[model samples]
Target: MTKKKKIKISELPNFDIVDYLKTDKDIAQYLTVVLEDGDPALFVAAIGDIARAKGMSEISKKSGVTRESLYRALKVEARPRFETVTKVIHALGMKLSVHA
Candidate 1:
């Protein structure tokens, strides 16, 4: 007979995806995967993660959107407008494209 030991959830190290998004390729790949999931909220959250990783202050300046607005727009389950998304993408040095 063997006894199993239980591990406490609090013992696990904290993990933040933003910390791993250190390069353009990494951010692109992450966003692509989120898009493939076909969930708008998830995609929005992914963008928010990348924005945080890249610095919300800089993104807001480049995107011409206020930092406060960006925060609200990118928050979880937020339904930001297309223009806002495009602006943020441009600020992040990325673009959107379509293909059949």
Candidate 2:
């Protein structure tokens, strides 16, 4: 019989989606998948991830929202206003659209 080696939990590298979101298409697809999941909190976290990837300061500048406010609004379990969500999406250089 062959023996198997065990790996410690700490041995695994941290997986951050923000690190992989390198392009607009990547962000779009990520958000799309999260939206399909239909979990509001998950969607918010996904947006936060993309925001971090793009730079919170830059997003705040483009969205005309304070960086602190962006962080508060995008955090998981945060029930931010629809207007704020739109602002962040626009700031991210994307738009929200409805499909039939």
Candidate 3:
């Protein structure tokens, strides 16, 4: 029998926080949690977590947006315009809000 490979947390790549953020499922879940908790900071924190996971520098380059702009848009007090939100979400491969 082959020896089982032991994986270490440190050895493993960081979780794909950006991929999670980019998915509709994740956004839905986050929205649900936010609605329940009523904390915009948590939402901003989540976005920041994803940005860090995906390498903010790379994301900024690919998204045609500055890292500082992204951070500002995701900040707790930020009132990002719909267009700005759309651009960020699209850049991140996420979908927008829809009414059913």
Candidate 4:
């Protein structure tokens, strides 16, 4: 009989979407996937992911949203105001576009 190998949690490779979203092309691809998911949480989560990718503190500063508020607003359970969302999006150098 052959022996099976076991892998520990610590032995697993770290995977972070933010790390993959370093370029405009990468961010666009990620956003395309998020939009395809058609889940609001995913959109909010995408923003959160981008925020983290660009440094939450810097995003907060650029958005005029406190770090605490940014964290709370992007939470899956939180329904933050549209204006606040816009600010964060703009801070991340992104904007919403409409399609027919």
The TM-scores, one per candidate, come to 0.91, 0.90, 0.52, 0.86
Of candidate 3, the 10-residue stretch with the lowest lDDT total is 45-54
| Deviation of model 4 at 14, angstroms | 2.7
Ranking by lDDT: 1, 2, 4, 3
TM-score of 1: 0.91
What would the per-residue lDDT of candidate 4 be over residues 8-59, giving only the tens digit for each residue? Answer: 9999999888888888888888988998999888788788888998899999
Q: Against the true structure, whose TM-score is highest?
A: 1
Q: Write the per-residue lDDT of candidate 3 for residues 1-100, one digit (tens) a residue.
A: 8999999989988764455665567766765676468675666555555555557777677677789988887766776665665566566666646477
Candidate 3 achieves a global lDDT of 0.66
TM-score of 4: 0.86
> Candidate 3: which pairs clash?
none
After superposing candidate 4, which stretches have Cα over 4 Å from the reference? Answer: 6-10
Ranking by TM-score: 1, 2, 4, 3
